[model samples]
Target: MTQKNKMKKYGSLFMATALLTGALAGCNTDEDTSSSGGSGNSASGDVIKIGANLELSGGVASYGSSIGDGAKLAIEEINAAGGIDGKQLELITVDNKSENSEATTAAIRLAEKEQVVAMLAPATSGNALATVEIANKYKVPIVTGSGTAPNVTVNDNGSVNEFAFRTCFIDPFQGTVAANFATKDLGAKNVAIYADNASDYAKGLAASFKETVLANGGTVVAEEAYVAKDVDFKSTLTNIKGKNPDFVFIPGYYEEVGLIVKQARDLGIDVPLMGADGWDSPTLIDLAGAKALNNTYITNHYSSEDPDASIQKFVEAFKGKYKEAPNAFHALGYDSIYFIVDAIKRVDGDITGEAIQKQLAATKDLSLITGTFTVDEFHNPVKSATVLEFVDGKQQFNSKVNP
Candidate 1:
């Protein structure tokens, strides 16, 4: 062949090699990138990215932090055990600043930017409700550790959102349980309820409690409302005291409940103080003192004193890791991670958000450390709750109330 022809052939071969290399690089760049935080696998296939939106700072900072820690512990344990499907779990957690809409927006950003497969929200009902719209829009599955309001899973039109689910029982069920315990077990014929009207959790619980109390032949002598951040309850307490009810039910968080209990007792309101699951916090006793907490009863997810094997194992593992016993929120937070992981394992392929949602909807009889959890049609846990009493500044398990 001529020298010019040989040069032309070599030039063509070089151009072909360059084109092939460029195409391969483009393919590699197009591959999904994984993240290193949150609950699910990352986008790059190297790790799973799970998004966590919590009230990590603000008035509910303590509760949010504890729940985030619990979720992190679970993720660490899962990673240490070889992770899900041989991929490292990454958490992309964002602090919601106790802003409901902001938290929801953060979750949406994580789903879009981080490309997370699933999300776990160890947050409040208000925040969870805000995020549910985004989850439904994007088909992202969200498992809430708290967020017990019935409306969390249902839209304003009363349609169930398949993407939204919770590990905790609904507030209505918890409220009914609390009311039954007060009227039948505590022998309280007349009850007064003080609810945080600003909180869906508090309002729902109070409504259900009032309905249950009246249905069971007991009366709600006084029903007062308060905002969550309000510290002064004397005015409300004074009004509640005028009713002279045998029991006072405060359906709110530990912070407000603690203050209300202390002020109520100081004002000579000696009636037994009853509350929902929100009262199961160490801060309740620390802030309210044992004197104020004495004779207080509250409904909870699980008790540290329970001898159940699942509960014992969880307590041991949690204490060994965090040097503290797990509360109801922590337990549920940990379980929420496992629930998502379990659903992910059951699913096949690229781990899209839609697949996770379907798997979550199909979840049945999931036996976690909390209890045997079965997601009802409304995506709420159909399980039993432990009734607890505050005895000498400690939560003592009194009995189990089944729904």
Candidate 2:
């Protein structure tokens, strides 16, 4: 049973921990979140309900909006091709407002009030982690398109959250790839790290990246920090510039990173800058002018410039629909909808959360717009990552790193 597409765990609930990262071996199947529906089977008559708790209106709005756009496109195509078992898929999206508390509230609404069979987690790791317990409690499979934090699937105590899954690789993989790119691809002997102090996302990437950088005999000449929502990076850039490092890695969201890049360039700090997927956003180019964004690179899920026929097809279709080229987040979002439907197709019995969760756990070698991947024991997707270079504020497909 294949054709339509190809592509791409949990521990306890750690309220505050490292963001963007792993898993436990145990699986739990407890049911309690739904009172009217059994095993969170909101899908009954002619529609399958899937909830999307996304950051649609705040700081990280771009990520959620792009994901929503991609998911909508997939739903349209799947419905046109005859949706799962003659039932149309319905996505109930709740705007998390890019806040953790809002995300949790949205998850509660989706799981308890809305009673969706399965739900899409938030785009950011911290926000996604906030919704894990809701999924586990309700026995609803919560799939995240780009939550790369390992703890999203596994707890700090080494327990796997059975209902949680992610399509993107964890932060360690992303960091290691970026470090290898900086040292091996860019020939850097020394590197500097500037991270978001307020975000575990930035901190997690910085930790993994530093370890790999030191492993490669590269020196961290300077380390700096900034909180989220920072508009001024000149002071930090001044310090970073004085270090005179060959490469600078800023593991933060697009908002701060954009200002950092523009200010860094203004200060004549012309070294190559790098980051993880958090840098993928349209607002980044507007914040940091195209010229300032040049010589920057990011370890991303997919690039619109990739020449693969499948990828190009998705890009063209996305451009036609949204009037803009798709980014890594968009591709991941598109892949996620198909991922859930793929699992639903294999369910012979009730389309309950338990049934869908079981099918999702056994997914193997499924290909999607991002890449082909299988769900690992920890519930994270083991897939290749792409390195995209920014030239004139546009992402160019650099190379792919296979695990």
Candidate 3:
């Protein structure tokens, strides 16, 4: 769906319907490459080509590697099921190393060099945003399993980036959910926000969480900033400790978040700690330790502990295949493949970027492991967010927050 065509289909809503970019899930780059078989658009042959621009290595590698593994699993399942409408799907992967520039380069390579009709975008917001123009220029729809920032789909001018789509909810949504869980569920009358100043993802979540805190008749006792790679947080946690807040919200990815959680516990500032999905990583436990992570919480896409039949089934399959439990990024990665294939199957005739783009935009109630959602005009999935509590160094499903 080109911007012009989208305007005709949805009208001026898409114009003011746009959003500005102020988000980053943050990607780190890795130097590696992989391919299944054959390249180029499936429209040219019987095998559909899919491009994966992922953060297979580098910082936040857990996010990229998990997503890649999930996408690979989905591709395997589809191919084993006799493929998409009898045409096999080929995943051509390029490691973005979790960097924004690398993400853009990967997109270009996949779209122009590989000639894939659609591409899977980098998992983080900043990296995903870097590829928007490329996706638009090439008219190839790029679906992200975990790009949860407004800017990924909408441009700064509030214009919709028609070719970009995400399976995860935006950062603001998860942030709001966190605030609600803290204030209402945990009975926190005062919440302190410790945001990663270097991350647009953290910044966006911080702003929304503050707004919700005030709206809920709660107080923002303290607010502090930290960069992405800072190892020490005792100074900041000490300041927060003085404030005597009932809860602490740290909006950051796992690497830093793990350190903060551990240091906070060491400082004896043991009020409940909460964050967005950025905290979803096994490394978090290794960093924070099981005892330190006891009261930590996060808003995530899916819980490995969910009792839903479909979710449990997926959990078992993922475990059986990977020999480890699948994280949210993995589930998102897996779901993204189905999302793209679902649209491809719905294309009227030959599968092309434009056709797949339109179908993706029109997707309604598409069921997947993360959440069932209808793609909104913003090119985001309208779905539920799960709040998980870290108990004994593992994420346990706590509750679900609906939009």
Kindly report which residue pairs in candidate 3 clash with one another. Answer: 18-158, 19-158, 25-125, 27-98, 28-97, 28-98, 29-97, 29-98, 30-97
Candidate no. 1 TM-score: 0.88
Q: Which candidate comes out best when scored by TM-score?
A: 2
Put down candidate 2 lDDT per residue, 1-403, tens digits, no spaces: 2432321112223422323221111111223422424565547889999899998999999999888889999998899999988999999999999999999999988987787988889999999999998888778899999898889999999999999999899999989999999999999988999999998788999999999999999999999999888788898889888889999999999998888999999999999999999999989999999999999999999888888899999989899999988888889889999999999999987888889999999999999999999998999898999999998878888999998
What does the lDDT read for residue 110 in candidate 1?
Answer: 77
Q: What TM-score goes with each of the models? A: 0.88, 0.90, 0.89
Instruction: Name the lDDT value of residue 97 in candidate 1.
Output: 89
What lDDT score is found at residue 312 in candidate 1?
A: 92
Candidate models: Cα lDDT each: 0.84, 0.89, 0.88
Q: Candidate 2: where are CA atoms >4 Å away?
A: 1-38
User: What tens digits encode model 3's per-residue C-alpha lDDT throughout 219-326?
Assistant: 999999999989999999999999999999999999999999999989999899998888888888888899999988889999988889999999998998999988
RMSD of each: 11.2, 12.8, 12.8
Error of 1 at 362 (Å): 0.5
| Model 2 error, position 378 (Å) | 0.2
